[model samples]
Target: MPQSHPASVSSRRILVAVVPPVLAAAAVLATFLSVRDRLPDRMAVHIGGGGHADGFSGQGSFLATALGVLVGDGVLFGALASWIRTNPGVQRVIAVIGGAVAVLTGWLIVAVLLANTDVADASSVTLPGVRAALAFAAAALYAAVGWLVCGKAEEAETVSGPSAGAGRLPLGDFETAGWTRVTGSRVLPVTGALVAATGIVVGFTTGWLPALPLLITGVPMALLTGARVTADRRGITVTPSLAPWPRLNVPLERIAEAGHRTVNPVRDFGGWGYRARPGASGIVLRSGDAISARLTTGSEFVVTVDDAATAAALLNTLADRERRTAAGG
Candidate 1:
């Protein structure tokens, strides 16, 4: 066999990219057809002929909704990939934004199909605000997934490229839990504040608490609980202070060298939070994975930080500082 030239390799990669998505579409269509009868009548109608302006049968509307969602998702992925081909950095932003859009689009298709009386009298089963909320939630989820896929794929390619992920940086020998230790994560507080504000609104609107009192209380609570790094002799800790639990901590000695890893939530590790891998611990974010610090003692901790490379740099710096201080003292 002859060796493939680099140009041939790039062409092959592009071909590979085009094939899988198309194969996936084919598989979906085949499965739907094979199980068409097993599916609900409304779903069948929806898929077959529900969205015609004339109004479809319940089954038709349902099927139409499903088909619409699949189509929309495909469009979302294709659009994002195309937009970010030349500028990979924009992948994360596009994925998050696109994922959110996908969700919203899915929600709307369902909502509209259900809302249309000609399709089916779905109004009785549907609640008022649920549609908007569902739409927003769906959009948010899809956009997040989009950002994750684009960003991570780009990261992997860049790392695997000729020069990027080369013989790791010269940051010296340090103990990393065979993974990355994240630092300077202070964005979580914003989430806590948002949650707290939502709680306050609900409390006030529902008369569970007076508006004036909640306004007075919520702001301070949000500020306190919002993004702050709390570190101790134990290890670095980060938590949304205002919302629920206190800070979570891990020991410093157990930390692995910090480095960024990108993962697509939709494809790679499922959704967010701590996910178990073969033998490693990692936190799944939009396009980054924070190394899981697992100590020999069996306790494990995950740090949620956006910039993995920067975070790793900070951790290395911290470790260096700690070592210097000890030697000097």
Candidate 2:
């Protein structure tokens, strides 16, 4: 039988994931109600380049669609949070992302309505470029708030035990061993560049404000394009090859066992670059050799790289030596 998350944990996650989006949806609905009398029957809901309203919709339909999307986000993220029984790290990330997205959507919709208010001609309405920046700011602010709302990771949490494996390196007493390998996704660079290029095209066609989100997403993807995976007495560390910070370090004490496995990026991890599924999470690049580490948190952290077998062996040997030292052997 699988373990169930505590009632409090379940409620916390559900609340964090669903409540913000629901509230944002309610706010959007309220704004629609307050401004419906003033807004034109057919109003501009979509803005294109030069701040021109290209898409027009009835006020009611617009509100319905906006609210539906906001609520849909709440529902989707809520369901995802429920499926995650443990691993607060992933839960917190999800909570912040969901909340931020809801806030962004709500903020943008409100901006649209406000721009059209008291306007005699719906086609003449021009949403200020600043609204895009404002929406991004609101999302960033809500992300911080969401982070504050969720409980921190449980440092004292313990799993049943580590997975037993037989891949220890032949390290003698006082003999040191270390493994280093560079591995990355084949698709990240090209995809990120393409997205950034698209943003540039959109900026030229529309406005810089509309392209902000895409650039924000693509720039980071382009920067943190690859990973350097290393294993030593320090356990395992995976960091961006181009940067020093924002690394994942599973300390020696947290590692249960290490082994190599074949990873299917989409099938196992859903996508690339630090993905999380129910019981597992990984820095998946291409689908090939990966170092799978069973963690004390009862979750697995995988990093795909070449020469993974040797890396796993070194980790197992270090773990055995640590156990012996702790036992006063």
Candidate 3:
């Protein structure tokens, strides 16, 4: 296999991280120039619930807002790329976020401009399905950017091995115990709820129904505020604490081995809860100590938690006992 030079890789990473927002700005500028002559002198910048113009702004002001968003996002993502150079997963997240922001801003600018072109009232402009399409497109672009920038997962040594003695717990007849931890973040859920509420209010008051989509997007954010992990003799299970129905279960039968290691959530799983990279999926709420289970199927599942070593040890012991019992039967 051909090895990549460190400098070359770094340069590529920089380009990948920095280009999306800049391109977004450029696209916005180009679109504005194309329709500048057609826009009304004073555009209906905001609409009320009755589908009437409730707010107006000059073309320059509108342009400034769009430009500001583009520039601000570019600067933020560019800085993040530099600050998080060691973690490609986080870098990919930053790139995707930048791209999404750019796409959404550009889409909004174009939509508003197209609505106001030669039109006397902005309220008369209705985007029946276009807003949804733009949202979907933005989501698609974000995922694509993350996937492309992050590339493939490297083949790291498995977090655990088949050797029964390594970090194994002592056997006790009919002993069963478990540990549970909640990976909670104070900021994320509150922010998500607030944003969702704001979007709902905006949608109802402005008749810009596009804001209603925020409610759906915000739900995941709020749910991601915390993840609950439980490790017992059966195996390990991870679920979002806020919404626990859908869970990731790693049964003892599937676990070939288990262990704990230090990990960066951004570096390992690309920014939190129920994340999937090329080779593995994990419940990654934060960066630090985590337990990893190497499954018999060859896939790995990880979760960041406190006392990961104990969890791994218990899991290994239980799994070994299960295998031995089955063999004897």
Candidate 4:
């Protein structure tokens, strides 16, 4: 399969995350412009089951609020997309959801405006169930469209992974070998410092008490930005770059096989640092080369680092040796 250039891939991901919310915001604006003369000064934003107006908001406030929310959603998703590079499935999922949100929100605002068309009293406006159904239908349609445009399927078949066909390093029965790598993200420490700085600014302006949360959040993030990943006779050990207290060790007895695979922090493991969900867990830092370990217990453990293929190969060799010893014993 053809590989996309790094710049092009990043650009496409950003476009997927950004375009939907922008269109939604534009739709709100267009609707407001087209029906401004017909709509009442105050429009019914909330309608009861009977289709009568139950709550109202001023025309300007309603439009401004809708724009703000849509823009904020776009920005949030865009940031998430930029950070997550390893999983296209996650990108498509986010794009589909984002498109759906935009369509639904824009449709709702448009519905309120359309219901108020030529009505003197905001309370006299009717928002039928059909209109709500139409909005959902439109949202679902947009979601489908977004899914098609956003990306291809998830990570392709890699040369190495926790699979039966994964490659292994040749090792003699009594040989000892190991692989180690130190991986860290420049973005994390910078982010931590920025967060800490914001906390300090808050502390000086407001009260020290309110800033503690940010301080607590920032300090550890900065300290634990780097990790040392080791694979050897003992299996895999992940320890913090500067400290040893917070460490993870996957014993040789636990891992059935080891191989390399790409990992997205947000998609596979939820976020950076220690993350666990059901039968899978990882010490995820960022998206890129990662060692994937399939355990005997049917769970999987992953850790992101550089030169992961070599690490995985070594791990597989070590595990094979351990298995032979167990069988002989």
Point to the candidate with the largest lDDT. 2
Compare candidates 1 and 3 on lDDT and give the better one: 3
TM-score list, all predictions: 0.31, 0.57, 0.72, 0.55
Once fitted onto the true fold, the runs of candidate 1 whose alpha carbons sit more than 4 angstroms away are 1-63, 66-232, 256-268, 288-329
Candidate 4 residue-wise lDDT, 206-320, digit = tens: 2244367779988888777789999989899999898887878999999898877887678665467787655678888888888889889877888889888888888888888
Cα displacement (Å) at residue 194, model 2: 15
Overall lDDT per candidate, in order of appearance: 0.42, 0.77, 0.68, 0.76
Task: Give model 2's clash tally.
Answer: 1
lDDT of 2 at 110: 85
Candidate 2 worst ten-residue window by lDDT: 155-164
- Across 181-285, the per-residue lDDT of candidate 2 in tens digits comes to 889776777767876986775454335665788788787877666889999999999988888889888888888888888876654554467786656777898
Name the regions of candidate 3 deviating beyond 4 angstroms.
1-10, 13-17, 26-42, 46-61, 76-97, 114-166, 190-214
The 10-residue segment of model 1 with minimum total lDDT is: 158-167
* TM-score sort, best first: 3, 2, 4, 1
RMSD, each candidate, Å? 14.1, 7.7, 5.0, 10.1
Better of 1 and 2 by lDDT: 2
Ranking by lDDT: 2, 4, 3, 1
Q: Clashes per prediction?
A: 34, 1, 0, 0
